[model samples]
Target: MAIISIANLLASYKSPESKDMWERICKSIGSQMENLPTLEGMRKIVTLSYNHLHYYLKGCIMYLSIFPEDYIITKKRLLKRWIAEGLVAEIRGLTLMEAAEAYYNELLSRNMIARADDPKWTVETCQVHDMVLEVMVSKSLEANFVSLVGGSYEGMSYGSIRRLSIHGGEVVSEGSRSNKIATSHGRKNDIQVMNMEHVRSLSMFGPEDNMKMLDRLGELRLLRVLDLE
Candidate 1:
């Protein structure tokens, strides 16, 4: 007997179309509905919203899938990569970096990413929610947009990787022990460069030998996005 408008329910959503999609998602999970929304239901709603983004926005968001879940992505690092990848369009009155910032803010307003708390870092930091990351990773891989190298693997079997993401602090490829791609917690100062000749975008985390790594950038001739910080 109580009346609650859909607007009140999805007030955070920016568009009416997105709100309608969320309603459809709720109905799709009808019988299973509980006091709290199920993760799958939320997943569908997020995915639907993601699908409605502008192509540029979609590309910018998908690029973050290269980072691991719960990882704090620095705003400077992200915007630089987006600019390098040509994802940020030039605005008449704004610099590329400024345009990139606008894109970042757009994503934030849509609730796709959350700002992180960092006291010392000069640049702002942000992170995606676990649910949003799950969808991003799934869709990114399906589209062959990026390949994440994590943990230990006996053998490497994959086609050409256009974008490569290496997780910091994890030993990658059990059989292939190459320091070139190995990450040391500031214990080692040597930069390790992998033989991903075709990789265009390279993102590394937790690597301290970044200055030395810059010396090897010439190896990746097609490199467009190089995010080491």
Candidate 2:
């Protein structure tokens, strides 16, 4: 005859377990849904759809992994690869490239993928929210995911990792600033000070020093939307 308050019950649940549930449910909605995070009440702008976004976005993005991490992706190249990977369906007159581009653009409009820092999406970066990354990493780790890094930053020592995300900083050396990227591959790419315009909402409240690395941090190209950021 013991009853626990709903709030108390949720509070008692482990942080890792709660986070894992969020990842699974969100992903079933949309691959980009994993890019969105709920952290300390902070919010972000990203794509959300009730349709078969999971299948569409997942196929579209995972196909792009043919390129390396931090590799600048262009619209044409993405479409070409998707077509080659059979990500695009064969429509009568619409070439596979066209279908793929349309799919990419749709995801972009919803903020699923960002427009590159430059035109042509050639230099475009694929970023997801940090909370999403945490959830992604947690999910992978729960499933024994382990990621590989090429930099010099000292990587995390945690075992039973199911996935890993890499960014700008390299393996740390004796407490150096390196491994910043590898340390938190599960993060949102909050942008700031783009020559005075396009400041990300996360930047509004973040301390200047804390924000220093947003621009410099690298991207996890090998991971698909499944890893969020």
TM-score of each predicted structure versus truth: 0.68, 0.39
TM-score, cand. 2 vs. native: 0.39
Estimate, for each residue in 24-54, the C-alpha lDDT of model 2 and write its tens digit.
Answer: 5444434332554443112221112212244
Task: State model 2's lDDT.
Answer: 0.39
Candidate 1's TM-score: 0.68
Q: Best candidate per lDDT, number? A: 1
Q: Report how far residue 92 has shifted in candidate 2, in Å.
A: 3.0
Q: What is the C-alpha RMSD of each candidate to the true structure, in Å?
A: 8.1, 15.9
lDDT of each residue in 1-229, candidate 1, tens digit only: 0011122224445585776867764564453334335655566666766776778899899988888668888888789888988889989999999999999997887777879987876778999887777778667766778665543211223356688775655554434323222221112211242456788987776564455446677778988777675
Error (Å) of candidate 2 at residue 217 is 30
